[model samples]
Target: MIAVMLEILGSALLGLGLAAAAAVLLAHRLPARRLVLLAGGIGALLGAYVTHEALGPGHVLVTLLGSLGVSAVVVSLLLRPAAQAAAPAPAHRAVP
Candidate 1:
């Protein structure tokens, strides 16, 4: 039980840290800050839960690593290319 709780806490922290770093490094490529953060946290939590369930207890380190990996993947999926500048419209001429 305690291990599970610790795993969750550690995973969440790792996820948030990863998200923050991505947001800072890939700010232009990522979406809104709030969305990134939320996704990171939730993704890590779910990852930890899934990993723990699959591998069972006594694998906290592995579970946290999995959670971090999952969170990174999830955040990376949200990345977008930098926006391109729009071309200017041509001037209209009056008809004779």
Candidate 2:
């Protein structure tokens, strides 16, 4: 049981990392939030499917929700700073 829990944790981390990478790459072409959402959704679906295949459908919903949360956090952490840095500073207005 412990080993199986560790395996699930590892799988979740792997899914998070991959989704983060994909969201970062997609950030070049799409808005960061959109990319993150897209990646998270995809990761969740994939994770759920894989977990279902390996562990049975009983685990699918939990894995799907967990992966979605993990992927969103990973993407936000990886891309939010980059997006902020890339954005232009607001122009200062002179007092009349």
Candidate 3:
């Protein structure tokens, strides 16, 4: 009961922290800040809930770790690839 609640709270905090770090470190690669934060927080919460249900109580550390992993994956999916410059078209040669 209480343990479960604590796990949820902890997982959510961890998720938010991870999102903030990602946003700061990879601002160019990530989407909007709000979206990243939302995805990370929700993903972690969902992960924690699922893990807790599957593993049951007495496994708080494992559950939190699982939640963090899930949150990271969710945030990573939102990342955009680095932009590349377009190549110029080759000049055509005139035939004699």
Error of 1 at 47 (Å): 0.7
lDDT of each: 0.94, 0.57, 0.95
lDDT of 1 by residue, 1-96 (tens): 899899999999999999999999999899999999999998899899999999999999999999999999999999997889998999999999
Selected candidate, larger lDDT, 1 vs 2: 1
Two-way TM-score contest, 1 vs 2, winner: 1
The residue-by-residue lDDT of candidate 2 on 1-96, one tens digit each, is 554465466555656566666765766644555556566655654555555566654464565556656555545554434344467888999999
Instruction: Let me know the TM-score candidate 3 reaches against the reference structure.
Output: 0.89
Model 3 pairs in collision: none
**Candidate 1 error regions (>4 Å):** 83-96
Lowest lDDT 10-residue stretch of candidate 1: 81-90
Alpha carbon lDDT at 82, candidate 2:
39
Per-prediction TM-score to the true structure, in the order listed: 0.84, 0.38, 0.89
User: Candidate 3: deviation at residue 85, Å?
Assistant: 2.5
Model 1 clash pairs? none
Compose the digit string of candidate 3's lDDT tens values, residues 1-96. 899889999999999999999999999999899999999999999889888989999999999999999999999999999999998999999999
